[model samples]
Target: MHQLNSLEKRAAIALALVFSTRMLGLFMLLPVFALYGEQLVGFSPLWIGLAIGAYGLTQAILQIPFGWLSDKIGRHKVMLLGLSLFVLGSVVAALAESVYMVTLGRVLQGAGAIAGAVLALAADLTREEQRPKVMAIIGASIGLSFAVAMVAGPLLARWAGLSGVFWFTAVLAVCAMLIVAFLVPKSVSKAPMAETLALPQSLAAMLKHGQLLRLDAGVLILHLMLTAMFVALPALLNQQHLAAERHWQVYLPVLLGSFLFMVPMMIIAMRRQQEKRYFLINVLLLVIAMLICWQATTLWGLVLALLVFFIGFNFLEASLPAMVSRVAPAGQRGSAMGIYSSSQFFGAFLGGLLGGAVAQQFGFVAIFAVLAGIGLVWLAIASTMQVPSRAQRLSLPVAVTTEQQAAALAAKLAALAGVQEVTILLADQRCYLKVSAQQFELAQAQSLVAVGNQ
Candidate 1:
């Protein structure tokens, strides 16, 4: 935080708010979609699952493209386009009269792909030393959004229904657009071209990087579990004759109770320097919870299972990115994050669709069994992963503009003391370095920036 200027902090907070508002619109339907989805024309439980997770599908496909586009067109410009797409999709969803149309709307909704763009832009504006603080704010916003959705979605569904919720999201999209235009300042980095990355290489680069792939795998599993549960949760609640309006009573307690357990473990992992051990244990717990959920017959049993479930879910959700931020190549952080994010949305889509089809035909028990199986496999893989301490990012402006000069400067910066990784972009005139924060202070990094300029 000492590294971040006032503008950077404000932008980070504003971006988080915008991101959460949009994400909430997507998740608001998750808690109770099954109740209303069945009423629309041609509503099969599986189709209903698609409608709920549709946005994720499009988001998954487009995030890397959008991130790359931002590198070429500027993050703000790319973000505005994404936001407009969201507004358009929201309108389509709000107007949908059938399940098929709603699915179309969801795909359109995901076309926004603004989240990656916004994150990239935030990184562009702030110093690397401040990113964790910035990311922490965004992460908190996401957790809060999930908590708020659990409390608010059901109540809103009772009053306005899914169409109404989409309309509300459409309105929020408009609000986010205005904020992007006027409130967020335009960013222009002065770093010489070599460190900043191109958008087109995002996906390919992420695919090839083993360290980043681990994080991506983790994200995919997390959302796979999330969407799978959401697909069945409402229908299960309905079996108890709980209306959409009343589902929150169950959600509220489960979410809150889980956080009580989740927060302490997160603290212990970081504070006690037991991140790898705790992370692996968390995945194992997820597997156990899934098995418990499969066997739950009473609402109390379900509630207990959910507490265990979210403790695993939320902890992984919080910790995965921090791990990626630490281990990914410095020049490729934006691209790595782009891939990680895409996997999350993709998992949501696949999870929802698969969970629905499986649950609709085989039974809810089968769905949990499948999810548990996946969790166990993921846990095994994760236990074998290299758990590296987080590496910090440092950005500096460069005076050179030509491609050759950018490459030369990158080499020079790479040779500098304590720099572990380097990325330089001639076009963006930016250079990014991954350095040991424990070994290098903010003032030292800043001084290096000055030296690079000279």
Candidate 2:
């Protein structure tokens, strides 16, 4: 791997902080909000579920648009604006007395859909060789924030209350805004190009791609089950043996143990050549987790089942973006990732609403059964997929001082052996290439580009 420059490392850290702040705000609410929501006046169980999912609903609607807009506007500018919106939303939620008001705050919170923009910006800013590593760093930060939030959120909720949690989120948002404004280094934004996809076309094409659809469906269903299960699981645990106050003892161990399992799986998946087999086996693990959760009884049994669930969850959560990098047509990757993200949020929304109702009526067993059914359907779809082969994620590098030179270079690179796809923008001073590993000849290709530079 090529070493990252200082600027690239700084950008990665800054971006990770921004992502973590946004995620912490959203995740902190999940552990305790729905249950307490019911105690508040005028709050129905359905409404509490809606409140839980409201951010995801709006985020799903706008993620693509925001990504497209960031392409036109400066990414940093869009990012700062989005962070400000998040702060505003947090303040609104913090002061709200009614369920409707809280729902509105959640919607506003989702309006700050700059996470995609940030990732796109990072891709734009970093070297192709370094981008994956930077992406991994940002992803790790998100996972860390989530685990910490689950354990910490309840404590803060107890100490400062949920409203206080929102207030803290608002402050974090301000910190994000400041980082975007002052800490992040400048880079050239993407100029409009013929190959760059429009919002509508991007969304439509993404939906039609069968592989991406399967992955998107899996995420939506998985999260829906997750949100809905949490809605009822704690309360159920209260009935069986453990009190709500001691729930973290269960969550902490399960989450930590799953990480232990996840590390080795990741090493094997990354190093081994059988991407298809690994992918399928991971999906099967989800099926097993669903079954375990379906039949869980003792407090320790619930923890064990969750351990299995996280094994599946962590594996899928990390792998989906890598899949997106492979499956999305090179030029439209930004918008494709945006659509993928929106689907994740929408899953959260649907899970909270539908999962709650199912559990309320038929009990938690039915909830797990429903999740298992969804996973089984996904596994069938996944099994049919021809997982993209392990190979270099193709991106072309070029240095040029003129449009004429860039056009000539682009043509020469496209004509080279192994080059399957090429996208060039003379205005942006960049090239993106997709070449198959079976056919790739990097040394010959490098010599060709070197001639263009001279």
Candidate 3:
């Protein structure tokens, strides 16, 4: 029931716009790129796939470094630099006459890697209790952006061709930069919190966490299937006698109907506390959808398959990150998310590489079969994942100056009723805790910390 204040609202809205615009630019190419990629020099299924996924490779590689860099220079500065790179890449891609140049542009675009910095700034601008709400807004924007891009990509391509789409993406990136410059509120706290910023020291432990790894693998496979599916889906529709320009007609209704179906499933899962059950079911749904896509001969048949696919895809996309937050250790959520995001981007790269290769060697239908197999494997791995506890994390400023004081304070906080975990960072003068949402008392925690400071 915690409400976001005025400043929090402004920050959340601005940051969400910035995040979504960049994502919109990135995604606009997914649906239309394969069809138009043939017009470029050195056009081939393999190169086309590589061009589609090249950005992900750089994004996965540089995102963590850019985040660490943000801590040194400042969040706003890093964001500006990142957005600038995105614009430059878009422009490069727009002007390219060859697949190689477009691939280079996509790689440059990925190098922006501003996701972590943006989230960190969000954390700095909002209170701990209000952070989840802000994150939800941003998450919702991403999903909405993806849905919009799927429809818009084909329409834009019909009007302007492939280069036109890239030009529009460049324009969107520039607008995002302007938003970052003027609309997004600056973070008041410069001190990085482990709950918000990735710590290099914690990376190994997060990598080793079995549960967190499952979620990471899940996102990787999810995006992999998504990108790989797109590698052939547009062409599949085109083969069904649907013109490229008319592709939006199919996407529009299918996405709308799928969203309607997905909402009820999400509601039921949450209300019934059957998230794990629903999660597995959704995975199974993806497998079934892929199999149908592989076999469908008619346009409507493919549409039906896509409808089923999106229902599962949308639900899993929303729920997986929530699972990561729940499974991550109290202070290491940032590190866990960092890894999860990298896995996601890397999966995109793999999808393009593998999908293109498969299409070249085995043809389009084989792509879906491969994806279905991957989904089955993922479902098996995910079956072992334990249900995460309903623990909420809180980070509070502490006044302890010495390690001894910090340790003593951490022990006291750990011993509090309903507190599941406590991590005190002396350097940051902050304490992070994971506690049962229903049983934890924030007032008591604040009082105890205040006394410890005194």
Q: State model 1's lDDT.
A: 0.79
TM-score, per-candidate, Cα-based: 0.89, 0.88, 0.97
Score candidate 2 by TM-score against the native: 0.88
**lDDT score, candidate 3:** 0.91
Ranking by lDDT: 3, 1, 2
Which prediction has the highest TM-score against the true structure? 3
Model 1 Cα lDDT, one tens digit per residue, 1-454 = 5667888877887888788888887788788777777778888878867888888899998887786687778888888899888888888888888989988988988999977677766767766557567768877888998888888888887889888888888888888888888887678762222223335555576788786787788889889888888887777777766766888998888888888998999889889889989998889888988888888787777777788888888899988988876777766666667677888999999898888788779976688889999998898778777877666676666666677766666676666666788777555556777876667555665565566566
Question: Candidate 2: global Cα-lDDT?
Answer: 0.76
Per-model CA lDDT versus the true structure:
0.79, 0.76, 0.91
lDDT of 3 by residue, 64-113 (tens): 88989998899899999999999999999999999999999999999999
Model 3 lDDT at residue 120: 90
Candidate 3 at residue 191, lDDT?
36
